[model samples]
Target: MRLEGYVIVSGDGMLADAGGSMPDSLKFEADYRFFSTALDAVDVVVHGRKSFEDQPNSPRRRRVIVTGKVASLADDPGNAKATLWNPAGAPFEAACAHAGVTEGIAAIIGGPGVFAMFLGRYDTFWLSQAPRVRVPGGHGVFPGVPERSPEDILRASGLHPTDTRVLDPAADVRVTAWRRS
Candidate 1:
């Protein structure tokens, strides 16, 4: 399966606010549309619990939420659209099967650790940066990794910038897709 990462960060490479949530200052309609479209193109979406919870339940997409529990949404009474998976307890392939995702692109939209989990595995990283916003003391996109810059982090994982497009010039938001060379 082709694994891909989708994230929107600040100029300083912060992915979330200090409160462990997406920064309000980085919210833009264009960016939201871009993300929504990308997710629509993918067959499976993988994200952390917090990111999944923040979004409204709709369209019932096949999704996997990284969690500590061994149970899946199939086992849960609520949220039949998603599956809760613990990578340490269950294999990724198994999780995909449980979600009924047999193949195609799997988009990893995250909160730090989930980003790190698919670092070298990601075929492409749709990295969006908002230059007008700066989230000081916010959560880094790769929390455990020691890399100083997001570019360096991706390069270290063997991915290089393939293309960059300005999604919104007025907001100074741009998206750069990094892929394995």
Candidate 2:
């Protein structure tokens, strides 16, 4: 099975601006385009409880949220497209099996700790490096990966830059994708 992940972050490595602000309208549009492209290559998505909460609603894919509390769509009211489970009790592989996604891509969206838990298991990572924006005390690229240059981590993870394109240079963001070799 191929496990894939994607993230849209600012140049400074912040996924969201301070206070969890949504990406700017332009950035959001670009993100949706990248998301649609990346998502087309996967069948399932695994996220942490925090990431799940951050989203307005569950996406239209076989979604899994790793949480200690049993998740119910009714409980969230807005999460109509996901099934929640406890990763500790039901391993991620088992959950994927139950979702009938035993092969192909499994995209792990971020929330740092979630990525840390499954980083070693993923086969590829698709990341979009938006132009640099300074956000004081905001979240960085990979929260738990120890403070280091993003380039270093990407290289260490066996991912090589496959493509790069400017997205509103005036906004100081560009979208870049890296693939595992």
Candidate 3:
């Protein structure tokens, strides 16, 4: 039940374009590398239906796609590696068990709602920033929440930026890990 989160946002705090997809201009090898590396250390990957569907393929061995349409893991057949989960119907632990993930970090990859679900529960949040990119009318990382910077939202949830690293200098992208204090 160690929930961790990851998001790559633009300078204007946008996680997705107007079309609700990641901006093509923001794609950088270094940012992707950091995300892949973070996923390597997690046992289960968690995301909303939009994010899950957007990524037809992934490196994650086990994933739980949060959706109200399905009651259990057997509902999703497109990806044998993933388990469909309705949080309203089953507990998080049960979803993990259904995914064959008994214990370890559960990485919450985004689409806003999924990130908000783990608001106060994230053990760590790896927030990567693309400084030069700005998605104006784009979706915020936590869409429905009150207007606040991603850093402020994380801080309000009791997570503080404890460490930072440059992921791609050429793209001016850097990642910061916010750990729960």
lDDT of each: 0.82, 0.63, 0.83
- Name the lDDT value of residue 137 in candidate 3: 88
Q: Please provide, for model 1 over 22-119, each residue's C-alpha lDDT reduced to its tens digit, 9 standing for 90 to 100.
A: 87888877888888878777888898877852344235578888988664333434667677888887788888888888799898988799999888
Candidate 3, residues 1-181: lDDT per residue as tens digits? 7998888999878888889988787788888877877777788889987784233237436888888887654546877778888878888888889888888899999879889988989999999999799898889998543267888989989999998999888888999999998
Better of 2 and 3 by lDDT: 3
* lDDT over C-alpha atoms for residue 155 of model 1: 90
TM-score of each: 0.92, 0.76, 0.91
Supply every candidate's count of residue pairs whose N, Cα or C atoms clash at under 3 angstroms: 0, 4, 0
Q: All candidates: CA RMSD in angstroms? A: 2.2, 3.9, 2.2
Tell me model 1's lDDT, rounded to 2 decimals: 0.82
Error of 2 at 181 (Å): 2.2
Error of 1 at 167 (Å): 0.7
Task: Give the winner by lDDT.
Answer: 3
Enumerate residue pairs that collide in model 3.
none
